[model samples]
Target: MDQEKPKSSALSEKSGVEQPEIVSKIAAGHIVALRNKNVAAADLISGILSGNITALSRAITLVESTNPEHLAKANEVINGCLPHANQSIRIGITGVPGVGKSTFIEAFGKHLTGIGKKVAVLAVDPSSTISHGSILGDKTRMEELVKDQNAFIRPSPSGETLGGVARKTRETITLCEAFGFDTIVIETVGVGQSETAVHSMVDFFLLLKISGAGDELQGIKRGIMEMADAIVINKADGDNIKKARLAKTEFNRALHLFPAKKSGWTPKVSTCSAITKDGIDEVWEMISEFLELTKSNHYFGEKRREQNQYWMLETIDERLKNHFYNDKNTIALLEQNKKAVQNNEISPFAAAQILLENYFKFNH
Candidate 1:
């Protein structure tokens, strides 16, 4: 699994000049510090490659950075670790705000662990600021799993995008698998009950819903319903038991409206009480059955291989966009061109064209 090592950290030294690594190190004082500011990240990346949990978390931080140099190294580290990746069941789970996504994950992850599966959770909520990392103390909420030796829970806010994924989530997924985690569960910041980007990259997409009778249907937009491979009426216990049952009936009726899934598994609408843990195994069985069905029919491997190609293109797009935006000259030109266009000195189209032209020229 040897990759041509990422051409040294030389690409990151600013000054608009690529200096020798020694010159950069001499100018910066510390060679080690010059690469990863998060000492934890280097250690963590090593752990991830070797299957260590603490190091895996640190590596995820490096991947999630808004900073440039860290991001470059993050890329190198994860790529070096990728041959060991893609071994897990990448499942994206989303639902409306009150759908108990965290609780269900805790239970589901426990079930995976009970059967000798290693599970990792990346709760994607992008609204979270640097000051606050994850949405809530789900680590506290899923206290049992948090402490489990076989489980690793990472709570990250879904970045300010509707894609239902946070920054660098793809890298985190890779890191999880490289560490020998076979089941990777990504929980998104449930957006109006629709599944989007996060689900697009996964092997199975699960949409959790609270059985709200007619009201529940209204909350879950039609688009999300269309994307669901499986829909579950969560919190199916106590007084809500009847409502959950009815919700399944309604969903089954509605699922019939859509075309058949590529995976060829009929989307099942089941009930589960994360609180009581009843039907937990049923949910697990449904997932296993779906996986077996897809894997047997060839969709499982084919879909994931397609996802890999998608990710390759996605990474190129993201990196190219970031490179252009981060080029200081590009930023300066963009601002100046924006004012010129606003003042009527230049047409908006010409101004944008200039930005695009200069971007390629400068980057080239």
Candidate 2:
């Protein structure tokens, strides 16, 4: 045996057995189906109206897509869903980082669902400037609310828009309303221009703040304070309770300095412990009172009408900007002009004018 070593097996030799044709056929069929599965706009509308979460998610994804092919279908779905929308309360929540926004929203959303209301939370996650990706971890943070059948949580990335609010958030709200969700909660990425954007789209705006973080009055943006329908002081537990109350008082005083809101309702300040779930009910009560007052005074409807008009104009501006910036010639010229301006070969205004003239010549 040693002398006559067995013939070495060749590594390149093919096996005698072959894979079944049926298996390959099935896989090919699946691939074909997947490749051809373009959901119709009417189907998406019907599914959304029937409260299908999967369809709603797909429709929202379509709305958020930047692909030129999706625009028409997205618009069709949105138009179909429009008639069923504007029936839910749109609440926008914003806070600085570490303000317990996710925790508070989880508790508040659960409370809404517990009271027989279908709740939809559209939480905007901040995108990384380097990678242009978002963590999208709200579902993981709101463990309980994510598990609730009556509650829907959709986390969207805040793209390169002026505010950190998602560009398609308003459209997402419409789809949620058509899905039979009576309560819509929008959580902004963080405090900034985001508050203004979210405030315009929501029926009520709540600003969350933590106690003992810094001077309550110092570094606070007057615009945010004025835009808030309520300022909620979070983490109001343990040794922080007294500090939270003081902050609330300060906010209430600051709110008084601003002129009365057009809504004819005064902004309220409250403190709540997201950990202990303390004062969460009172927060809802405050919002309820606001809704009652606004509806009775007809400010609610008027505000919504004004918002619709604002969004229409904003859409036009956004489209024009996109068209100009996305053109190949414009992109090339912009880079050249940028370099020229940086090198002092041309003035900034002159570079801008050249780029604008070129863009208009091609576009017009």
Candidate 3:
């Protein structure tokens, strides 16, 4: 009888009444507020000018978007931000995959912020050929910098081509500058055409290398080395210190072989251990010297003017290319010609010419 009494449940039976909404009203209100948030150009411009990181990030996303409407709004935001931009130092850093570009940038960025400078790092991650997607893992790699209040780190996919990626990055730099970041660092995807793209946008170009990573001079690309304002030998601590100094000497000699840069400043080569934070200050001092020389000689402003002109022409070219490719008729013709060329029924050049003519005619 006691066992039977114990079997009776103390819990209440289920009610037939319907339950209230699972989400709390406060949370629902917050979500609705975010959804209905005003992202107008004027509001974004105001927020960006006041150093609102969220606004700056949203504006950058708008710039990177492919939507025509978003692009128009992005242009408006850029135009508004232009008056406040060009007041910051834009630095570009490039290196091979294993040269520790992310680590170097994180260390350098933290140093800049420590000196009371607001720093922004724009890291470009290479897109996969098959998936056309990027890992965008720079934020994860730069753990400390990402947590720094004075630092901002943004990693973007290196789109279909370096040109597209560079364009977006340049715009992002303007937004960051307008947001009061005095130091803007653009890290390229790798040591290739991306170096040139980044070089054209930044005031200072830095090339990072490591010692004993094969001959210091063997895999070096001439164009990249020429564009470099400074060659930094990273990973220079531990057993790598001596080798790094020797590599620096080799790079210094190699740098001398190239004609003097038009800026009239010799490219400096130095070694640093990103892990140990050794010689990082010298890197910034070197950059400061370059700035003093360039600014005093008026080359800094002149170079910026030239870059503006170059980007203007590039924008025109990109717009025309997009116009041609996005045309419905051109897309159709392109598909047909692609198949024809594959079948050897038509030469690639001829097919390209036919597509171009069709595009022009249709546009006219």
Best by lDDT: 2
Error of 2 at 230 (Å): 0.7
| TM-score-best of 2 and 3 | 3
TM-score of each: 0.81, 0.89, 0.90
Model 2 misplaced regions, further than 4 Å = 1-36
Off by over 4 Å in 3: 1-38, 163-166
Q: What is the C-alpha lDDT of each candidate?
A: 0.80, 0.91, 0.88
How far residue 327's Cα lies from its native spot in candidate 1, in Å, is 1.8
lDDT of 2: 0.91
Q: At residue 356, what lDDT does model 2 achieve?
A: 90
Question: Tens-digit lDDT track for model 3 on 247-327?
Answer: 988888787788888999999999998999998999999999999999999999999999999999888998898888888
Candidate 1 displacement at residue 51 in angstroms: 3.5
Predictions ranked by lDDT, top down? 2, 3, 1
Of 1 and 3, the candidate ahead on lDDT is 3
